[model samples]
Target: MSIKSFAARIFASHIRNKIDKWASNPHNTQQKVFEELINKAKDTRFGKDHEFSEIKSHSEFVKKVPVRDYEELKDYVDMMVEGQEDILWPGKPLYYAKTSGTTSGAKYIPLTKDSMPTHINAARNAILCYIADSGNSKFVDGKMIFLQGSPELDEKNGVKLGRLSGIVAHYVPGYLQKNRMPSWETNCIEDWEDKVDAIVDETLKEDMSVISGIPSWVQMYFERLIDKTGKKVGEIFPNFNLFIYGGVNYEPYRTKFESLIGRKVDSIELYPASEGFFAFQDRQDANGMLLQLDSGMFYEFIKVEDFYSENPERLILKEVEVGVNYVMIISTTAGLWAYNLGDTVQFTSTKPYRLIVSGRIKHFISAFGEHVIAKEVEQAMKEAVAESGAEISEFTVAPQINPKGEELPYHEWYIEFEQEPEDLDKFAELIDRSLQKQNSYYLDLIEGHILQRLKITKVPRNGFQDYMKSIGKLGGQNKLPRLSNDRKIADKLNEII
Candidate 1:
């Protein structure tokens, strides 16, 4: 092995040992984190308001603090934005990660000194673990590209504000500064397409060993690279073997990516948000990302089925069961207490607490009492694509509550296909059947004739891209929902269908 690879392996060994030590006792680790968080923030304004000093246990904490999403948490965040120290965390946040919100135009999630390391370290550790497991770290010697928002900052009350990915850009370890790519100027280009072209120009001839980005944006870059050089991505960057991605499921895009790259490359899935870096894939053979129980965050889970129930029970890491859909809640070093993250997760392993982000709590279709989630639709599409030998670029599902004639209401899927199925109607049935198998409610709706199987609307090539562009959200962590209860997405898609 090369010197760099040997050193990496050594470091990986240390990191893995550290992870295993804490991960072996997840609940104890989480309890320590919870205690630390409570201790650190007990004197803060939020802590004082919530009677944190009196709270001694999870049950007491739960009673003192109610689970809150961005909207509910905004009052405290607003005070923090207006330069109030001790409003959330102990002092002013080091930075504010500005993310888009549905009702609120933008949400500024605090990134404090204590919480920031978890974000950067989780990403770093993911790679380290991969190297340790695979015994390959040659990529560490070559160039790496992280397709992300520009490292530009807008200040609000002395707090640096930018997209989470952009803020992360500024925090790329000094060791990686030389290996990172696109050049700072290229990354700063406001237009995503222009930035991508510049990226292609800069890295076309250089050695690129690692590439990380949201799948959709990275797909665009890959397409541009192929078009420019008339070669597959694998050919262009022969050393590129590792893809680190988050923000969306990669399975549905796997086939299209393989075709684009002309080979399969290993990938790491991350579960990160502006709030915190929660989990990451630990082993190549693992079914899910290992939840970061040892990270400076404490987790609580509400069963998805019970989430809407009055006073839904919140279970801690030790109380959680595998394979159940849960709405994850957290009290973090970032000072987000009992924060409802909005994303749903399913625990796949409880021994070390690993989970997959299942779907968003709000992004579900239950128009006819059949609560179909994003995971179900994404998995169904994966199954359909595998079975039908078809390729999809992007797709979304929405309930068609009312039909023009006397036709039954059904789920409408807007699909952009790279390779169309031989029988489109049959392909739709395949996806429907997959969904039925996964969700019993959906099955009952179909079997009872309350809804038709499903209708496939083949969108024109690049339809989703066009839709995103029209809305001025072409890239940079922007992803359309996998499914929705309302016809908002479906109605707009019908214009081009």
Candidate 2:
């Protein structure tokens, strides 16, 4: 088993080296590069079957496979959970990385030997980009922390299997690994619950110079650090120079997190998952880390106009329209072909392919008939904060259907700050005005007052992190979703406000 795994890794490395060469070419046309990748995807294999064997060509594959969400993949997930290998891959998958999906509840994303390299390489590239950001290649020579998911894999009957962390830990390069932490933190082998505690405890013991995880989880650790030392974030871990996070938007929570840590550390955005690591923030400021699309997977983007224009066709990456939201599809070395990841992104520029995440299409707030998309909310919040001239440490907006009081639903914002605003009412009004100005649809809805009210609740300093910890989702994989459009969360926020 070890020998076969090693061989698979070698083949992957060789492919990656070739890709690096192609990507480095200054004049290589994207069309030529994509066609080459499509050819490669057609030939890569896992055990006996070719990955995406069902599709003969990239064009055919993209045309035939309708974009799928987690629900559409439930039966495939059931197969992995049942340890069936015939349909998906040759043998049992390495481990299932538990991930949360909208409506589907808890999902076990399949991870196999072929897929693991994407995570490693993507992480390495992220660090490398950070190094470029810092202008120091040796930036990661000091201690580093990875806030990730629980290692335990669930068995067919719901029994907890061995730790997924342990299984993948050893694959990490030795020179950069931390010594104080147990092998499990890096190994991907230990049980999930144990691994979380172990990672947290170990991080507490060391002079961690760099930390990486979801912002929500990182905030939870800050709260824990405060309780442990009675020291504010800036005082407790003032030495940390680099703070990298992904899995969720960091803008809303940035102010509160930076305040606790007492320093504005440099940050990098990582786009990764059990299936594959696709992109990272590039080292250069202007160049969004050119997505390492040529890595283990081929990427495609669907135009938002086409997506919403009654036409159901998908758009290829080369054909994406700027400023429109599109779902990302990937065909990876792992056993997936033309897989829709459900993440929505909009292109900032087409030349180098810079983009900004626009939030999940499946999870927007449409309550009370207000088309308050994530981008609309983000822009409104940014504009409001800018207009109010009052600092916002952190904030989240939920659409609420007020029970008993009025038939019209409203928007409520939960804001946390280091200090209180002089006039809370004006601050809320500013936010409302900004939303009205930015989105025409929202403005139309507001004119009719479809959403009658906007309410703000000031949270105790450091309260948001406490909420994240309460959920048992600190670091690595679990993230505090920016917009929890669920009725339950909205109802709870309404009660608190």
Candidate 3:
């Protein structure tokens, strides 16, 4: 093995051992630890002196602050963009992380020097815990690998800052920071599309062992990697040991990715954003046990139904029930207070607060009285495709109701596959059967027969990526909206149909 690969493997192995030690310890209660952190965050931002010098007494600061969101920090970000003092902290902000949030096109989230330690600590804990869980602490003794953003900076300051990925790229370990592939390799970099092709070219040459990013981008990368190498992923990257997937659910793409690699790839899911790295999956098979950076921020959970009902009740971590879906609200050290991310999750257990992603609350389809969640739809599709003895290359579902004055509303499935099914009718029936069995709403709608039918049409291969690229929003961080509940997406799909 090359010297760099050998070193990376060693580092990877070391990180795993550290994480295993932390995960197995009984004294680390996320709930208690994080609750203390929440109070610290409040004092830092809201104390009378605009400073967080001393906060030894927790009760003195617990209920003093109100929940905050991005709206509260609008002025703070505006100040930083103008090179003013940091509105969130005492000093000026070194960089800003940009993210596309719901109801807002793009939000510039400021990252301060004060919150740096929290970010580093949480991220390290996340990595080490994964290593312990995988029984692959030995792999850490090797060189480090990071699938990260571009290193380019702005011309004026010679500091290529401003993008969310770029801001994160700035914080990588100094020793391995130089190992990052060009920002151009990503289909994004804020403005420059000049070297999109070159970026893709150089990435194929790198010795990547640990890959990290949203599952969507990894999906696109594997497709390109397969085509370029003319060999399956297993043959090309035999040294690759871990695959870290975050930003979204990895369930839908899990089987597909595992099969392509030809071996079980150790994976880690991260719950991070431009705002902060809130939580990470600490155990391999424990879903995601939240390691509350109680020091970085405070969390509040609003029950899924209560969030939508006339009277909304937000619960504390201690009051949270297992198996109940809740909307996450976070108050961070940076600036955001009581910010609702709009994502939904359910607890697998509350003793440690392990959660399973339910779906985005706003991304549900309710046409024809058949409420379909993205998680349910994804699971149904996976089971359906498996049972049909067919492989789905790409697919999307658009809810079309009463088109051309029809009385019923049903889903229009756009499917694409490599090999045509020998029995197309059976393929359609299998998908329908899967949905009927998995989703209660779909089952009820089918029994009532309120919806006319579930229609499946084969589209060109890579059609999903084509759609994603057309929008200029393909790859990591950005995802193909599983449930196109908006009129624009629905109308666009209708046009394609």
Taken over the whole model, the C-alpha lDDT of each candidate is 0.91, 0.61, 0.62
lDDT comparison, 1 vs 3, better candidate:
1
Off by over 4 Å in 1: none
- Tens-place lDDT per residue, model 2, 109-146, is 66666677767777766665444345544334456676
Candidate 1 TM-score, true structure as reference = 0.99
All-Cα superposition RMSD per candidate: 1.0, 6.4, 4.6
How do the residues 202-295 of candidate 3 rate in per-residue lDDT, one tens digit apiece?
Answer: 6666655666777656666666778777877666767677787676667656667776677787778877667677668877777565645354
Worst 10 residues of 2 by lDDT: 43-52
C-alpha lDDT of candidate 1 relative to the true structure? 0.91
Winner on TM-score (1 vs 3): 1
TM-score of 2: 0.79
Report RMSD for candidate 2.
6.4
Per-residue CA lDDT of model 1 for 1-497, tens digit only, reads: 66877788999989999998998988789889888889889999999999989988999998999999989999999999999999889889999999888787789899999999999999999999998888889999999999998888999989999988889898887878999997999988889888999999999989999999999889999999999989999999999999999989999999999999999999999998998999999999999998888779999999999988989999988888888999999988888989999999998998777889999999999999998999999999999999999999999998888888989999999999999999998999899899999999999998999999899888998899888887888888888889898988888777766
Candidate 2 lDDT score relative to the true structure: 0.61
Worst 10 residues of 3 by lDDT: 151-160
What's the residue-level lDDT of 122 in candidate 3?
Answer: 70
